[model samples]
Target: MSSSFRAPPIPSSDEIDLVALFQVIWKQKKLVLAATASAGLIAAIYAFLTPPQYEVSSVLRPAAINELDALNRSEIYTLPPGDALVRVGASLESYDTRLGFFRSNQKLFKAFEQPGRTLEQSFEEFNRNSIELILPDPKKANSLSAYIKLEMSYPKGVDGVAILNGFVDYAIATEREQIAADLDVIVKNRLNELKGKIDAARSNYEVDKEARIASLRETDSLRRAQLQDELKALRAQLKTGRIDRVAQLNEAIGIAKSLGIRKPSTPSALGESERNGSSSVMRTEINNQQIPLYFMGVEALEAERTVLMQRKSDDFTEGRIAQIAKELQLLQSNREIEVLNRRENEDLFLAGVQPVRAEEARLRNLSIDMSRLKLVTIDKQALEPLRPVKPQKALIILLGLILGGFVGAFIAVIRHLVKTRQSQPQSAALSMLSNSPTMVGSDTGLNKP
Candidate 1:
């Protein structure tokens, strides 16, 4: 009398009953609504507490060619308009430039100050996030914008417009100053080079002048020595000539005494005879006969010799002596050397100075005020924005509501599935108990007993 009983077949795991799932959700709808309401309320609170951010932007256009002509035409430095604007853009992109601006104008950035953070740290954040520079996209063919856009997002209560404008002016001014400094450096270096050349020329001039003076002195010394030698030789010759003349006169005087001739007489004169106080010429024939020096009277020879011996200086006898004396006197003082030594301004005498002076004058005139130069222009200045750029309350509330609905729906589904699984084993056990024949027969026996 054994009884066989089987439980009802369980539904497949793949099977889904949409109506039942909805029913479970409907039963837990209150919990779902409460969760959704809670999420939505939190979202609203957060959106309301968050501060607003204001955005200010400005546009920078390239300066005109006329604006940069002054720089381009300068002899010191030539920078085109494109290069100038590029410099400005690079300055705006520099991190140090931004930080310097912030530090110098702390009053303008007070709103960015946060507790427990240093000024630098706060500036780091501001530099990284608050500022934006919009440039043309090179990848796109039509993206070539002739201007650059600078934008800044500041928290509420901040004057973003004024700061942006000031920064534009600051960047432009800084770049301009840098250009000026570069020009100054170039000019200064060139001027120093020119000065060095001038100094070198002056030094060379001095050296040449000294060399010339030395040459003049040497020439004078040589000429003076030559003149002295000539003077000595002339004096010696004059003395020798006087002694020879005196000797000749003495000999002539001796011969004249020996011959008993007291006066000058030629051979022809000896042939003349005086007849009765009248002189008669006995020798009238033509004959080539030389006259002897001793034929002159001793008185005349002695007189001439005495004159030669009495001569103190032979210089008066020679005209060349006077000329030599004059030349030697001139050589005694070198006029050229004296003039060179007395010269106060030596640059006037230097060679090849016309071109140098011209170049120097041009460089000197190249100096100009660089502050007036304009590198970039701010085409559009930033204005005070009336509306905040961030913290959209409506969008935040809507997103929060949608997110809460999803979370609440997920919770309800999980609760319904948990309840359904817990009741499944109980239902299977009840079906098995009711269907068992052994339990039915036991009940019958219990009734019979």
Candidate 2:
């Protein structure tokens, strides 16, 4: 007995029909052509209607002569040499500075603004469409020989050129102002430092001079006191009567000898003459003992006085004191000169500082002019663009054509799949109806007949 169920037939490789696929695609040819033509037409219309955007670009090499050098030559503020040019160039190319420049400059924004647009919106649009800054090679990034490329795009060719030129001018001016402001700060700081040094030096010198004079005065007072003590001792010895008595006795003895008295008589026991002579002999004996003592004391005092005077003279001689005075004078003079020199330097530095702003302004203006004159060369100036750099018509058309074809193929395949599924259900329903048992004269059939 055969089984009642039959398995569904699987399509073999040979049954995979390319001809059917071609027929289906042919049947949908109009839809394909319509899609293709519509895409082409839309692309053509967009290419024709959209305003052309012209781009203007300029190239700048690092200035051969530095901006700082120009300022120095102008006798303004001096700047250190290495990497200043590189730093400035980098600043000019910075995204933030560039964005700020675009946002702030009324003229640059004027070309890109639309009606009812806010400043921020206009800036956003301009930033998106307009400016591009190209830096130097990554390998030689820090090299001084590197360049900066600036590009600007606008709907109008003239506007593009104008905006670019204006931007270049603005960048130079802004950079100049920034450098000058920095220089002003540096100059002012240096001036303050010099002034402080001058003041400190003057104070030190004054303190040193006062201390030296005080030392001299103290030494002089001590020496004077010693000399005064020696003088007092000599005066006390002169006021004593012993020295006078000795001198008078020596004179009397000499006188007696001159009057032909061979021996000075010693007094006898019984007379007035004896009494006077006895007193004289006694006084003479007392005088002889005290005279030597007085003389020794006087001699010693005189010798001491002489030594003291010599020492005082040596210690405080006119020449030595004068030498000290001269040395002090010289020291004071040198200090004065130093103070004066420092003061002068301070003044000069202040003088240099005072006009720094004006000088920087002047030099900055000169630098700007020099930059314009190609001293700091603009390697290439932006030219008016001859053609639009956007709205690439050929590429747009080709892409549209490819997209249309893909869309057309997708729609056709979907339609084919739906028709295949519907037919399968209908055929299965027909098989069921045809295979249904037909009883001979069934009740429902007989009623229908």
Candidate 3:
């Protein structure tokens, strides 16, 4: 029986009393309409009056196409590799002085200057605020690398696209001009440096040649003086004691005659005693004076002859070597002159520079790339906006209407429930209270009244 009672008849959605709800809405139709219409109108006016925001989108190729060509043809004249040749002029140690000269370009500084800032400060500001560049990932298969994207939002009624385009054009033009001017300055400076090097090399050649010639002259003079001294010594020795070959032969013959020595026409018969006595006397005379005199004469003649011959040979050799050295100096000087002459003679004007020409070709390629740049697939484009994207008027209106209606319905239902409760069986409730013995009278004898 308790189960059959079914938990005091649970309320179902079927018993929601839709007819009653409709009757209440019909009764308050004017209020509901007034509230919904007012809220919707306010939403529409707010959407229309509010300022619109414009989003400006522009794309830049971060990296120019044909990077290899640009690199190859770029007019930048980079400094050479080693410090040995890195110097600008003869006094390579004065690098600061050279750098000071290089930095003295007023025009470049002025061009780089920004309003209300120093030149350096201006340059930093411009560099920092310049168009943001995006580099492509090498791992990707995309042919394009490095692109720049610019985002700008402007107030309503402004020509955002046109303004942004103008700014981009101005930025790119300024960068290009600056690059060209800087490169020109660098090249001219490098040429001047080369000129300085040539001057220094020429000076070195002169100094070296002069020193070598002076050394040769000094050596030759000293050698000649030494040879003269040696000749004077030989002449003195000859005057004091010179050997006579004729006198020697004559003395030998006369001595042989004086000794009664038999001339051996062929073989001769002679006593051993006589031969021995003759040989002994001759040996004794030679030991005493003749032999010493003869040997001295022979040695003096040989020494004088040797000294004269050596001096003659030395003079000849010195003259030849000096001639060769002088010729070498001339050749070296000529070679240095030729190098300078070649550099001077090279007509960098009549014939176009190979590097600049190459760069020209690259420039053409860059131009082609610039021409080809277009949005192949545009995800979005600037539109006239037939209906403004903002405001969402209908949705706003619907939401306000729904909300206001729900609130009104809730108030109406609460009021109805209160009125019905007030009118329900008050007399029956009072009679039940009066019959209960537990109910007490008021302190003023309300029960008798």
Best by lDDT: 1
Which scores greater on TM-score, model 1 or model 2? 1
Misplaced by over 4 Å in model 2 are 1-23, 65-82, 93-105, 114-121, 136-145, 241-377, 413-449
What are the per-residue Cα lDDT tens digits for candidate 3 across 253-345?
Answer: 455445444342111222443566434322212133324222233334344445544342232323444554454455444444444445553
Residue 254, candidate 3: alpha-carbon lDDT: 51
**Could you report the Cα RMSD, in angstroms, for every candidate shown?**
4.4, 11.4, 15.4
Q: Candidate 3: lDDT over CA atoms?
A: 0.46
Clashing pairs in 1: none
Quote model 1's TM-score. 0.81
Clashes of each: 0, 0, 5
Candidate 1 residue-wise lDDT, 294-347, digit = tens:
878777777887898888877787777888899988987888888899998889
Worst 10 residues of 2 by lDDT: 285-294
- The candidate with the higher TM-score, 1 or 3, is 1
Model 2, C-alpha of 159: deviation from truth (Å): 1.7
Off by over 4 Å in 3: 1-30, 75-146, 181-203, 234-449
- Which candidate number has the best TM-score? 1
- Root-mean-square deviation of candidate 3: 15.4
The order of the candidates by lDDT, greatest first, is 1, 2, 3
User: Across residues 1-449, which tens digit of lDDT does each residue of candidate 2 receive?
Assistant: 12233445767857758888878888998887777877877887888788877788987765555544656575545444324445556566666666667776677467666899987787787767677888777876576566678888777533677677767766766666677677667656655665565566556655665675566566655655555554454444443433454554455445444433333332231143445654433322223332322223333444444554334223232344444445444443334444444553333433234454444445345542333322234779898776788787888888788788777867887888798878887787777666455433354566783
